[model samples]
Target: MLRTTLVAAMLLATTPAFAQPEPARVEVNGMHMYYEVSGEGPPLIVLHGAYMNIETMGAIIPALAESHTVYALELQGHGRTTDIDRPITYQNLADDVAGFMEAVGIGKASVFGYSMGANAGLQMVIRHPEKVDRAVLASVAYDAKGWQPEFLAFLPQLAPEFFVGTPVEDEYRRLAANPEGFPALVDKLIALEHEPLAWEADVAKIETPILIVQGDADTPSPEHAVAMLRLLGGGTMGDMGAPLPASRLAILPGTSHTALMNQPELLKALIGPFLRGETPKGMFD
Candidate 1:
């Protein structure tokens, strides 16, 4: 009996400290939302790019979980969440996200998203600002015009074949209820991207402080990003006598959209302060 107890202790001590429990599933708005909640501070919600799910941000989520109750979710039709016939619109997705928060009992949280997730984050701020404390919108624009001509042209090129044998497909198949429906999900996102989407006027209504993260060569030109800031009362020249705009913008040099998600350490360093309601100094470099 003593030897058995000693063996169990050895096994327990060797287990990794940072290992997170498996995601828990909850039904919200008729969709099964699979989310992993970790850490024990203020809540931070994470949304991933289109055609991808929570795992796409895998590298970054753990670091964020260090100081936050990271509510990383698989949106409807993404990852383990089965799709409904309602179609995949940003507005509907935002509603789903809002409902998820209510079901999980989170009041207001620091919402952060990348690519499709970023767009969804903006939609959340628009449709459900009451539930959002701070927001991070990365690698996205407010409307069709915000995306550059070349990037706009690149949307149709995102065929299912492009993701075959990649991590995106592997992760999708691993957790998706219907792995065969991956192509259809890709089609829906492409069609949505092609459709004329405009919300620049809505930007003025978003009173929530937002941190805009974009790569210098991202799909939306830096000028378009600046325009977003202007609407958020950021681009105007405020004197040292006054407070800086609640909205903060970061345009990382030599960074591409693909490179952005891959650099969790860099993102953590830059975003840590903003999440805490502090301005990040010298992020342009």
Candidate 2:
């Protein structure tokens, strides 16, 4: 028995420290939320995109965990926090995030959100301004409607056979298998057809330091980015000498919509320092 115990101890000691299990689930506004907390320092909350979970930010979590305490959450109806009954809207999602932080006893935290997650971050900053110290919205658009055109355009490019054979098909099959809940799930996606968050007014109210990161190659068009920059009151343009703020735009060269996952160096360089309160080198040139 002593030898067995010794072996167990050895295995535990050899395990990578960063591979620790995620924290226990906690109730947030009557919903069970799964979250992982790590590192020690100022708190940073990461919100993942639609149809994704906390693990979607897996690429940068290790780097972020090195200096800041990272809180990664699985949003309602996604990942492990399934069976959500609430109507899906940016505000509802934001409230869920705020409630999650409150349940965890964190009064304020810096927020980093990607894609649909960025919309939630914006809503959080708007509704719970006091709870957000700083915010980073990566690969976001000024209008929620901006997603419709691209999705419609891309859907045709992907063969129906591809959708049928892909792993995502399994998720679709699973949802369809649920006779009782499948209708509601379909309704939710239908509601998302008309994204409710419009930027013209909300952009004016944001007072927190905002970082907008986009890849020149990833964005289907420059119009959305241009609109976002204009609404943010502009910043020092990068090598272009344009009026856009250097702080507002981190345009990665030759990257696509999912650049954050593919370009670690660029993401680390842009996000690491912004989170540390240091300006990235050459950001304003």
Candidate 3:
């Protein structure tokens, strides 16, 4: 999927007007994390994908900013944030997110995370439920097995040299506090991809409302998305007298994991109402 993301990043030329908000740095989880705050209203933290930064999020940040105060972050080893000794596991990243919220004075906030960010957000909702009001997890999977076979096959072959001439490498060198650490960062992330993780039971117990978004042709299998929805109290026949589930699922057509970031209008239309607790109106309702 990193290949898909590389192509998408290369295609992304027009940066959003709100993309360059002055970033603030804070010490969170023993790392100097860089984040930018924009818009107004309730706090909403936007997390970027693997090897991505806030600027790579495209127009989605401004779209979300229209309603919520968007706090876009560059996680460990990415963007302006320098690397630490710790491995890039979801659990560690989730803890970093919780610590960041506390440092920023946001007791509870909604989360919008994509790709690796989404997986970390899932862990956050499971491990630190009290800190998250709700979440939007895009292209997320419960375990490594949830990914498509092709994507799984591509992981072991991933190397830093694969990104040398790509935008991901270019952006890393352009914004990283330690630009030379790009190879190390890529190595750690590849290790993360190989790490085992399964949270079905944990996900089933989460009380926080969640919206699972994925593309029909994304890395995470469609079956896995549906299974995750079921775990989140979704996948019910609401029109048949069953109550609406606290969580929801959205599968965007003609979109890939990388292309999902480019769909600002579609994402805003779905995420805005969900975060505001506005349920969709049906004929039966």
lDDT of 3 by residue, 1-285 (tens): 233444335345536457456679999988999999988899999988888788778889988988989999988898898799999988988999999999989999999998888988999999999999999998899866788898878777766677677767777899988878988988888778778878888998999999999889888999999999998888888776656988999999998777787788999999998898887778888
The candidate 2 region of ten consecutive residues with least summed lDDT is: 1-10
Tens-digit per-residue lDDT, 1-285, candidate 1: 001111122222221223474579899888778887777689999997775656555567888888888888888788788877666878888898999999989888989888778888999999999999999888867877776687656555556576556655666688789888777776666566665578877888889999999889777789988999989989765555566889988899897666666677789887889899875354331
Off by over 4 Å in 1: 1-18, 156-167, 280-285
As for candidate 2, its clashing pairs are 235-244, 235-245, 236-245
lDDT of 3 at 88: 92
Better of 2 and 3 by TM-score: 3
Instruction: For residue 194, give model 3's deviation from the true position in Å.
Output: 0.4
> Local error of candidate 1 at 134, Å?
0.7
For model 3, state the Cα shift of residue 180 in Å.
1.0
Give model 2 RMSD, 1 decimal. Answer: 10.2
TM match of model 2 to true structure: 0.77
- TM-scores for the candidates: 0.87, 0.77, 0.94
lDDT (Cα) of model 1: 0.76
Q: All candidates' lDDT scores?
A: 0.76, 0.63, 0.85
